[model samples]
Target: MAINILLTDTSSPLGIGLRNKFESTTFRFVAEHPAELSWRDESQVREYLAEVKPHLVLNTIGWGEGTAIKPDLLADGAECLGRCLAGSSASVLHLSSYRIFHGEGKVSHTEADVPKAASDLSKAFAQAESAILGALPSSLVLRSSWVLSTEGGSLLARLLADFEAGRSTVISEHWRGTPVMVSDVVRAVYAVTQQIIYGANNWGVMHFGSSDVCSESVFAHKIQDMVQAETGRLLQLEAIETETDNSAVLEVRRLRDCFGLQPRSWRQGLRPAVRRWLDRRGLLAEVDSAVVEND
Candidate 1:
């Protein structure tokens, strides 16, 4: 027979990418717009599982993709998942953010380390992660950082949209982070899910985001440069102080120990994000037509 996998998330770039990455059969995907749908609602999720009977569940649903993370939603969602999947044995891979740590110094975060979250969302994500991990040992927690999808629908989308609209942004000069491409994160999610189910790897929290970590200002400038080169528009970026309360370099020993996977650098992922955004923007039209289309 064929293998069945379910990709769960709200309407984020990475969430959308998951469906696209696993569009072909043998690697069937079950996806829903978690932003509109309540994955926290046990009855709803159970219904989805019943319908899909997925061998593995990749949960990309969270509030922090573009919006500031919400504490209530995080807690409630986990409470719901605990009740809903209390019995089902489907292995789960919960996608998390690099914001879980909020201090200084370059230190690698492992699956065993208790993270100090940087924001409200990260804190709640931490809570939910604890709850889910406690309930399901087979569950895998994927702690990732900044993820770029060049389209104007995700974090990259917001940044690019701001730049295209001639808005100046003040990026944190001190706050640096790893940025994973939507494609890379999705690929890792799928790979970890596969390893857990077929390869029978014991589950735990893992770090599977980009290895390259940089400041928001640097990250923004790179994007600004790319768009400027492509559209001949300069983007203004101001630097601001940023802080981290967690380890700068996190250990991926557990992840490698389990599946021997290493993610791509954020730089490698940028070109694709730009291309996708340009495609979405329909930038290929003749200048006159492009003007007309805008008009």
Candidate 2:
């Protein structure tokens, strides 16, 4: 049977990339953004859920950059949606972040890792996860790292911004990530939802991402060289700090063994991000002007 699913993805910039890469192959999806819902709209949604009896409710709604909005709202809204769909056989896939971890020792965090969220946003999300885990035990929590969109604001955007302005941008040498492409994450999430592997019974928190750990400096150098070789302008990588900590490094062993998920290499993921960013900024033609000498 074609599973009927409703997806909330207000922060979707990867557009058809998401729909094409995953959604089309899986559930019969009814996707909506944040603006599409309301207290009344939720009542309507509940009615629709009761009437349609969807097999799953996938929420990818989040706020990182928009109006001076509170991050707690996203968490709260997600919790509310979870509660509303409670006991409908429509399990949730909460897309949480690795940023929630405190920058402590080299912790290969697991489902049992103590919650040590540092910032307000992270705290809010942590709180939301608590609510979901506490209430709907069937929900799946995916803690992801540096999930860069192939076509959006990410490490690539910030780097491209500096590169285009003729400023010598320095990628923090100390910063490191597994850096899963958003497309890959989306595909994995779709699998989690549609029961290709773990479904409602696959309880507990699980880490997900490609299996490549590279420091931000190394990453920057690779991207800079890729751009320069493709165009001939040099970009620099400087030793610096990344707020990201070891907890976010994620003990992805669970996902690896369970799904046999062979994530693409970060190099494969990054070149496209760089190219996309360069193309979006119209710096593709003037790739030489896109950077300064790295030292």
Candidate 3:
């Protein structure tokens, strides 16, 4: 029997990536957009779940990937979903962000550390996680940092847009983070879901990201270098120092030990991600054939 998977939002990049990942598999994928139903209303959520009868629910409605859902609303929606799934056989996987930690140290934040919640957004994320875990203790909350995607309002998308428009790509020199490709996230989700389906009781907060870390400027320069090497277009890259400490690093030992998943370098996905972005905009025609073949 195919496992029925219900996706909360199919429009987000993560949702799209998940769809692409599981489409050819035996898992049956179904989705409900935020506009179709009121996520804050528990009754509506219950009705929808009962109608779908999904064995697994993937909650992708959150702050990142250019989602318009507000932070407070996200918390409310999660609360409703958790309540609806309580006492049921269904399992949930909530996607969360690592921005909840506001520490300045170089050490990666672990699942054991409490969220600092320095900003309103972070506070809402913490509240959402609390609501989900409080209602469904067996649920999984996967938090990631610096998710890079070719679609939507991701950081890489914005930088690529700037480079395409012949504008200087200004990046921060102080901010540091571990970038994880959306495809990697989808792979993690599939691996974890398979475990859960097979009766693995590992549930709660887990972090996943690239094994390496770098400053915003360095990551941008890498993208710049790829574009230049592939298309022979030199983009102006500028680094600016910022007083605000926006560094976010996630410790992946918990996820690695639990799922036996090893982290891969973010550079491994750089070329393909850039190629997809450029190909979407009809810019890949200018790319060198040799470089494309090598990539």
Candidate 4:
């Protein structure tokens, strides 16, 4: 039997990646775009869930700029989803950001660490996470760091696009994190869903990210190197020195111990992702054109 999966926030990078990967599978992937539905409306959410009858609800919504992450929306929407899912047998999986843990001096935050959200965005995400967990105690929550995708306006894609357009930017060197690929996130979700469907019954919050923790400057340089290696394009990326440290490392022990899945480092995943991005946009040949023009 195909597990009916209802996904909210389909417009997000993670949601889009999930749909691309799992749409053709035995799992029935149904998405609801935020623009198409009023997420804050409790009655509307209830009606939709009743109609979908999803065995698993993957709520990948978040506080992205220019998106629906307003305080009212976050409060009302989370309350609605949590309230609705509480009555149904469907399991909920809420995607969260690692930025929620704003404590200093900690290299990595684990499941045991309490969230100390510093910014408004992190606070909002924390509140939403709490709402879902409070409503559905058996639900799964994931605090993922630096989610990168080959498609869309993700940071990686945007940087590549900028490089293609001959734009040079300064990146801070003090910030550090292990950027997890969107494909890996989707895979992790799939693995957990399988366990949930098969009655594995290990449900709680967990952190997910690549094993390699590097600074933003290092990650930027790595992407530049990968793109150059893949397409012979030399992108200008300057690293600006910073004295203040901004580190976001997540401990993935639970992810490994629980699901038996170990995510690969960004180095292992960058080449194919860059190639795929260049291929999709036909930007692979742009380097050659630039070379010829320069000549």
Candidate 5:
């Protein structure tokens, strides 16, 4: 049976990506943005939940830029959504961030490590997770790191734009994480939802992302190299050191054990991401035409 899913914050990057990813018969999805519920309005969220009465509420809300994470807003919204879903049978699945961790030690953060949210954005993330989990016991809080996709003007798009303008892009040499592809994130979430639908009855926080870890600078260079390989355009990249401890490499053992998923390498996923970016800019056709002309 297809689960009726209510997706909140559909206007955000992740929300939009979720919409694109779930365009199939796997599950029935109804999308709503912040404009509908507004901020910290528990009554609005409660009313919407009553109207929808969905079997699963996929709360992908609080979609902000990677650079700017608003914790207070996120926490309030999570609390509101959690309270709304508390009285219903709808299982809530909330997307969280790895930025909640301090990323202090060299080892990757496991589900066990205590969260040390250094920045206000990360602190908000931590609070939000707690609020939802407390309200909805059957909720699944999946914390992900460096979610990248080809849709919209995401960080990846911004980087490409900078490259196209002949500007040297600066990538942080210190910041590190297992940058997961947003496509993989969608798949992982679906897998977990399937488990829930089938009565697996396991719900709590878990980490999800690719297996490998790399510095932001390294990842940026990989993107540059891949684009060059595809379009023959060399982009100048500048690497710099940073004192910020925003780095987090996820511990994915739970993802492997629970969902039976060993995530694919981010490099393998990058081709499609870059292809999407080029397609969005209409440069994909240009690249194809150039290839044909050269041939």
Candidate 6:
């Protein structure tokens, strides 16, 4: 029997990528749009859960850009969903960000470290995690940083747009993060979900991302280099020093030890991610021709 999975927030990049990932799998996927669902209302959530009867719930409610929902509302929705799922057999895999921790120096944050909510967004994320775990102790909260994809308003998409429009890309030198491709995130999600389906009791928090970390400027320059190499177009990149230096690097040892999942460098996915971004905009052919001509 195929495991029924309910995926919330189907409009986000992570949601889109996850849907694509599960298309060929044995899991039966059901998508729920964020606009259609009210997370804060317990009765509504309970009715939806009873209707869907999902064996696994992938809650990705407010992890995207341009989300109109307030932070408190998002947290409330998570708590409500958790409470609703408390007596049910369905397992939850919630998405979170590494922004919950304010990294000190080069230290990678472990799951044992307390999440330092430095900003409002981080505070909301922490609260959501607590609410879900408190409501459902078996729930898994996966924290990642710098999620990049070809679709939506991801950092990679914005950089590609800036380069295509001949706009100078401004990057901060002080901000550092571990960039992970959305596809890799999907891989981790699938692996963990499958383990859960197989009756593995490992739950709570896990951090997953690329092994290496770099500043925003370095990441932007790497993207610029790949674009220039492929399409023979180099856009001006301006690196500005910021007053605050914040690093969000996640320690992935727990994910590896628990799930036996290995981390891949974000650089490994950069070229293909860039190519996909170009292909989406109908510019891949031009890039291919440019490369061929140069050869």
Best by lDDT: 3
What digit string (tens of lDDT, one per residue) describes model 2 on residues 125-180? 68767766766767777787776653345665556656777777666655566777
Winning candidate number (TM-score): 3
Give the TM-score (vs. native) of candidate 4.
0.87
Among all windows of 10 consecutive residues in model 3, the one with the lowest summed lDDT is: 61-70
Better of 1 and 5 by lDDT: 5
Rank the candidate models, highest TM-score first: 3, 6, 5, 4, 1, 2
Rank all candidate structures by their lDDT, best first, as comma-separated numbers. 3, 6, 4, 5, 1, 2
The candidate, 3 or 5, that scores higher on lDDT is: 3
Question: Of models 3 and 6, which has the larger lDDT?
Answer: 3
State TM-scores per candidate.
Answer: 0.83, 0.81, 0.91, 0.87, 0.89, 0.90
User: For candidate 2, what is the lDDT?
Assistant: 0.62
Candidates in order have lDDT scores of 0.67, 0.62, 0.80, 0.76, 0.74, 0.80
Compute the lDDT of residue 109 as modeled in candidate 5.
Answer: 84
Give the per-residue lDDT of model 5 (tens digit) for 82-133: 7777766778888888877864544578877778776577678888888888
Which ranges in model 1 have alpha carbons more than 4 Å from their true place?
A: 32-37, 68-71, 103-108, 117-119, 152-155, 242-249, 282-295
Q: Regarding lDDT, does 2 or 3 come out ahead?
A: 3
In angstroms, the error of model 1 at 293 is 16
Clashing pairs in 5: none
lDDT of 6: 0.80
List candidate 2 segments past 4 Å from native: 14-16, 33-36, 39-48, 63-70, 105-107, 168-170, 196-200, 236-238, 241-247, 285-295
Model 3 spans > 4 angstroms off? 32-35, 66-69, 102-107, 285-295
